[model samples]
Structure formats: structure tokens, C-alpha cells
Target: MASAESASLGRKVRTAARWSLVNTVVLRLGNFATGIVLARFALGPAEWGVYGVAQTVLMVLLSANELGVGLAVVRWEGDLRRFAPTVQTLSTLSSGLLYLVLFAAAPALADALGSPSASWVLRVMCVSVVLDGLAQVPNGVITREFAQIRRLVLDSVNFGISTGVTLGLAFAGWGAMSFAVGALAGNAASLLGAVIAAPGAFRFGWNRAEAGALLRFGLPLAGASLLALGVVNVDTLIVGATLGKVALGYYVLAFNMSGWPVRVVSEAARRVSFAGFSRLAESAGPALADGFSRALRVLVTGTVPMCVLLAGLAAPVVGLVYGHEWLPAARALPWLMALGLTRIGCELAYDCLVAIGARHALLAVQGLWLAALIPTLFGGARLDGIAGVSAGHALVAAGLVVPAFLLALRRGGIGVRVVARACAWPFLAGAAMAAVLVGLPRALGHSLLALAAASAGALAVYALGVLPTRHALLGVEPRHGRHARPRALLPGPSRPPVPPPRHSSESDPEPLLDGTGADGVRP
Candidate 1:
């Protein structure tokens, strides 16, 4: 009976991870398409920069408001349905409070940043945050229930509707306000979708037992989130302060362009990985190690070449995507790509560590890195403008790699040397592809046709090179584990049925990493 249960749980995790990954990727791609259009037609660099700052501020505040309740809810090993109302009430109240705080402080915040216009932007964005917060707990419940496709559809519909609305406003020359409009539209759509698909009322239950238990777990998670966000956004804040709105706009453009590649790949990986690791953590040491190893391989193999390709193709890509006036972004691309790659490394370690019940370790590492990041950001922004921001990011990336490797080694018993060995081939292959792309274009006089052919050829070569290397690193083709694969979703050869580990305790362990031996996996 125990073995059968474990097997069933493992299969469920595998299936959920795959679907979640697909849904995330599809959603991101849809957003990406709309973003490209918006970036090109709807907003110029300065307007885009303002939009970026507004959006970034809203995101930071949103993260603060949720205060890690979603993770706690996921970590809740008890009855998810029973916990749902409490989570909903808590999240809604917290968000409402945050909205009040943001609105009260908006004028002062705008003055502090020397941008009076920010007050209006901040006020508009606060509305979205509140609505966004209302959805978090219900979203968490849906995720816990393994309803990823529904989540995906909700996200798609929200973004699709918002994009359409925002584009119409942009065509009418609504400028920076267009972004705020789109964000409001998107949040409203998201709230509506959450209500329809996963209905839950937000009564202030204030269940002391439930709220207290969640807070104990959630506060640390919240701290970790704040530290991480602070590190990531300090550059923007500093750039905005030191460079002013117009220059900050350019810097943000570069920053966003640089981060997009990593976002594309990591976003999908994270959704699947969090749930999958939670499920696998219940198994024994060897099984956990195997899962960790596979996850790392997937992250590195996907992220490294993307960084390399983006770095190499930075100029052309910027021209193609955002037009010629935004050429400054290219200067930051290589550094940003490098930063993106290290971020992928750190994230892999983070997911594995978190899944294996190392929340304290996760918080500590994130704090240390954020501490290191502060001076790097301020000094870099002051020194060389936007490029300085990239320089700081690069420095942080370089510093973070060793620590991440060590943590993965310490927590999961993954060897540093083994990681280095696995990374070697992919790094080499990426470098080779970069060289070919760079050399071929110049040699052929760099026509658009020539560049296209060279880029295509380089991609083909890189793909061929990574295929064998990936197999060696992961012990199988990654396509085998891809969430979108029908065979993978079905029971198949790679997914041989394995028995669940036996348990004779008072309760089954929660499947996710929850600072305990929980046997349940929440996405």
C-alpha cells in the first residue's frame, strides 16, 4: 500500500510539473508577443522607462503585500480546502493595507525620487496591486490542487485582454498612462478568472491558530522574498536616482532586454521544478540527489547557450525587437546575459535547497548576496551609468556562482567538481556558437540575409553540440521530461512506476519542502 501510494504521488508530481511548465511557457510567450508590440509601437524609451519603473515598484510592493503567504499555503500539509479561506482572508487584508500605505506615501515617494509625475503612476499602480493580492491565495489554492492548466488559461486570458486594450490606448497616444491602463485591465481580468475558476470569499476569519501557524512559516519566506527583490531591483532604484528619468529609461531598457532570455527559460522551469522537487523530496537521499542533478542540468543547459546567443546577437536583436533608437541596450546585453546565466545557477540551487527543507539556508544565502549587491549597485550606477549597472550585476553574478555551487553541494550532496564537469561542455559549445555567429556575419559583409543565415546555422550547430552533452549531463534527452510531451503526460518508459516510501507517522509528510519532512507537493 505504501509503495503504491508513493508511486501514485510521483506520477502526479511528474504530470503536474510538466503541465505547469507548458502553461507557464505558453503564457510567457503570449505576453512576450504583446510586449514586443507595445515596446515598439506604444512607448518610446522615456515612456517605456517610466512604465518600467511603475511596474517594478508595483511588483516590489505586491511581493511585500503577499508576505510569502502563498509559499506557506503551499507548505501547509493539512487539508488544503480548510486552509483556503484563511489564506484568502489574510492575503486580501494584507494587500489592502499595502495599497493604503502606498497611496498615502505616493506624493512623498515621488518627491524623494525627484519625479513628481511618479505620484500619479504610483497611485494607479497601487490599485492593480490590491486586486493582484486578492487573487494570490485563491491562485495558491488552485496551484495546490494541481489545476495548472486552469491557472494558465486565466493568465493567458488576462494578458490577452489587457494587451488588446493597451494597444488600443497606445494607438490613441495615451503614452505612459497606457501601461497603467493595461495593468489595471490585466489585474481585473485575473481577479475575475480566479473567482470563476476557483471561487472563494474573503471573510476576515482571522483564525488565530491558522494565521499564527502560517505566519510562523510565512514570515521567513517573506524575508527571503524581500531580500531577493531588493537585490534585483536596487539597480533600477539607483539608476533612477542617479541617472534621472530619461537616462534611467535607457538603462531600464537594457536591463529588461538583458533579463528577458533568462525569464523566458527560468519562468517555466521554476513552475515545474518547485512542484516536482516537493514531490521528490519525500523519497530517500539517492532519489532526491537524482532529482536535483536532473534539475540542475536542465537549468544550465537551457540558460547558458541562451546567454551566449543573446550576448552575441545583442545588437541585431535589439535592432530587430525595439528598433534603432534603442541601440544603447546592446551595450548592456552581454553583462546582462552573464548576470542572467548566474541567476539561473542560483535559482537551481534555490529550488533544490528549498524543496529539501533548507529555508533558513535559502534565506541566509539570499541575504548575503543582497548585502553584497548593495554596494555593487550604488557604486556601479555612480561610476559608468547604465553600463555600471550591468557591471555590478556581472560582479554579483561572478561572486554568486561559487556560493551557489557550494550550497548545492552541501545541501544536496551534489559535487562541485561534478557540476563543473557538467557545465564545461555546454559552456564550450556556447562559446563555439558565439564565435561562428560573430565571424560568419563579418566575413560575409553583414547583410540582413547573411546575418540570418549565419544565425540559423549557428543555432543548428549549437543544438547538435548540446544534444550529446545534455544527454551526458542529464542521463537522458530533456525532451523526454518536457511537460508538453503527450507521452510524458501519459505513463511512459521514462516514467516507470515507483513505490511510495512507507510512512507510519501520525500524518503523511507534506509533499513539498516546508522546513519539515512533508510528503505533499504544492506548486
Candidate 2:
């Protein structure tokens, strides 16, 4: 029975991973297509800049609305029935309040941006804020309940519908409203999907104790998010302020393309990690350490090479996706891709912090990122164009990211050596692959076809180089390998001595329990 359950869990993990990867690819592709086409038609530099600013405001508000309510609920996974009401009631009230404040502030923000037109965009997006907040508690519940696959499916469908609607309207010459229409459609679809996907009847009632716990867990997250948002988006703000809207539009194009892969991988990993890690934090030092190591291995392996390849192929990829008019963005692309590595690293560290119940540490790390980001961005934007802005981000990433990881590692009681060990070979392999891709394409005068061929070859070579260590690090052989078993991707039990002793008082403690739920392992 145990074996069967384990096998069932493994299947679920693989299915979820597959669905997540596919959904991310589809969503990114849809956005890329519609955005490119829209850029060709309706919006220009200034309008795009205004649009970017408005979206950032909306995102900040939305993030603030959730704060860390979802995380707190997931952590309080003791009783979903009680937790659900707490989440719903608190989030709804908070969302309503935030909407009022943000909507009221929209006009002043428009004035700040020197674009009164931004007010309407901000107002329209206010609806998303409210809807997003309402969705939060349910969405968190679904995800924590291991019903993520359902959430993924519903959101994917919503994205498809939204993208289709937006593009159709855009081509019909609806201008900025086209994108807004699509967003509205997507949000509505998402709300309905969340409602259906959620497990129980919608209920809301205040519980002061639960709300206090949630506020403790969530407030720092909100602060962290706000700071991180500033760290991430300040470049665009600077670009719009300094270089004008046209340049900001170009920068957004490159930024989105480069950052999309990171978003897909990191967000998927985070969803799984947040739930899985929170559960693991309850017991077993080695199990938690092993889990962290294995998760890092898979994330770095998958993310690092992709980032390097994107950096190498930035020019051609951007050209193909967004058109020649966006060619200037290619200069910004490699740096943007480099920024993804930092972004992913930050995510990994944050997940570790969340896993270890050190949310405050994560908040501090976010503040560190902003501290590094601000001055460099100011300097970079003044010195260079958007490209310089990207360089500044890379600098901030390098300067502040290490401390975040160190802090997470310390808090988790996991040795930094474990993380470093997992990262070494993958980083080397990715770097080597990147160098090969860059050299091969340049040696061949950088034909698009040649770049494509070289990229494939580089990835293959890198994979081969990592093959020996793959089993140890990735916790599984390749999918096609001879050692076939369910849950192959997960790490086996840690050797007893590798993990710290469970307690000084006990002579022998049973091994730490395995953290489950990746690929759908129930236990």
C-alpha cells in the first residue's frame, strides 16, 4: 500500500510539472504574439510607458492586497475548514480597503508620471486588484491543498481566452483598450475558474486571532514585495523618465522576453516549493536539507542553461519574436537574461526562507536587493540607455544576492556547502554551454539557423557533461534511462550521518520524513 501510494504521488508530480511547463510556454507564447502584433498597430512609446507604469501600480496594489495571507493560510494547514474562512474574510476586507486607497491615489500617480491618461488605465486595473484579492484566499487554498493542477488548467484556459479576445480587439484598432479588454476578460475567467476550483462554499467571517497570525506572516511579505517591485521596476520608471516612452516601450519588450523563462520556471517551482517546504519544516533536518538540495539542483539545472542560451541568442530571438523595430532591445536582452539568474537565485533563497519559517529574513533580503538596485540603476540609466539600466540590475543581483542565500542557509540550518555543491557542476556546465554557443555562432557569423543549431549542440554537450552527477544531484537519471521507477526525480533518503543529529537527548531518532507533493506525492 505504501509503495502504491508513493508511485501514485510520483505520477502526480510529473503530471503537474508537465502541465506547468506547457501552461507557462503557452501563456508566454500567447503574450509574445499578441504583444508583438499590438506593438505593430496601436500603442507607441509614450503610451506604452504610461501603460507600463499603470500595470506596475496595479501589480504593487495586488501584491499588497494579498500580503502574505496565502502563505499564512498554507502554513496553518492544520484545518482547511477554519483556515478557509479566515483567509476569505481577512483578504476580502483587505482587498476592498486597498482598492479604495489605490483608486484614490491613481490621479496623483498620473500626475507624477506626467500622463493624465494613465489614470483610466490605473482605474480599470483597479478592478483586477479587487478580483485578484478575492481570488487570493481561494487560490492559496487550492494550491496548498495540492489542487494546483486544477488551478493551472483553469488559468491556462483563461489566458487563452484573454489573449484571443485581446488580439482580436487589438487588430480591430481598439488601441490601449484592447489590452485592457483582454485583461478584464482574463480576470473574470480566472475568478470563475477559482470559484469552481476552490474546494468549499464561499464563506467569510472575521477571526481576530487568525487575522493577527496572518498579519504577522503576511505584512513582511507585503513589504518585501513592495521593495522587490521597486528593485525590479525602477529601471522602467527611470527609462520612461529619462529616455522617453519609446525607449521604455523597447525596454519592456526586451525585459518581458528575457524575463519570461525565469517567471515560468521560478513561479512553478515556488508554488510547489511553498507548499512542500512548509510541510517539511515541521520535522527532520536531513530530509529538509536533502529536499532543499534536490530542489536547488533541479531549478539551477533547468533554469541556468536556458538563461545562458537566451543571453547568447538574445538578438535573433528578440528579432524573431518582436520584429526588427525591436532590434535595439537585443542589446538589453543578454543583460536582462543575466538578471534572470539573479531573479531565480533570489526565488530559490526566498523559498528556502519560506520553508524554514523565516519570512522576515526573506523580507530583509528583498530590502537588500532594493538597496543594491537603486543607486546602480540611477547611475546606469544616466550613463547608458536601457542597456545600462540592465547592467545596473546585474550589479545589484551580484552584490546583494549572496547575502540572501547565506541568510536562508543559516536560518534553515542547512549548510551552505550543500547548496554550493549542487550549484557548482550545473553552473559550470551552463557556463561552458554558453561559451560554446557564443563562440560557435560568432564563428559562423551568427546566422539564425546556425545559432539554433549551435544552441541545440551546446545544450546536448552540457547535458552530457552533467550526466555522471545528474543522478546524485537531480535525484534521478534521465527519463529514458534504464533504472525505471516512479518518483525517480526525487532524492532517495539521505545517509544518516550526512544530516545533523535530530536531538541531543534521544539516543536514536527515526530518520527524518521525506517531504512529499512534488509531482503530486500526497504524503
Q: Top TM-score: which candidate number? A: 2
lDDT of 2: 0.65
At residue 173, give the lDDT of candidate 2. Answer: 67
Candidate 2 per-residue C-alpha lDDT over 103-137 given as tens digits, one digit per residue, 9 for 90 to 100:
88888877675556777777775666667667765
Provide TM-scores for the models.
0.86, 0.87
Best by lDDT, which number?
A: 2
Off by over 4 Å in 2: 1-15, 472-474, 477-523
Query: For model 1, how does the per-residue alpha-carbon lDDT over 207-228 read when each residue is reduced to its tens digit?
Result: 6676766666566666766666
Against the true structure, candidate 1 reaches a TM-score of: 0.86
Supply the TM-score for candidate 2: 0.87
- Number of clashing residue pairs in every model? 13, 4
- The residue ranges of model 1 lying beyond 4 angstroms of the native Cα positions read 1-10, 199-204, 401-405, 469-523
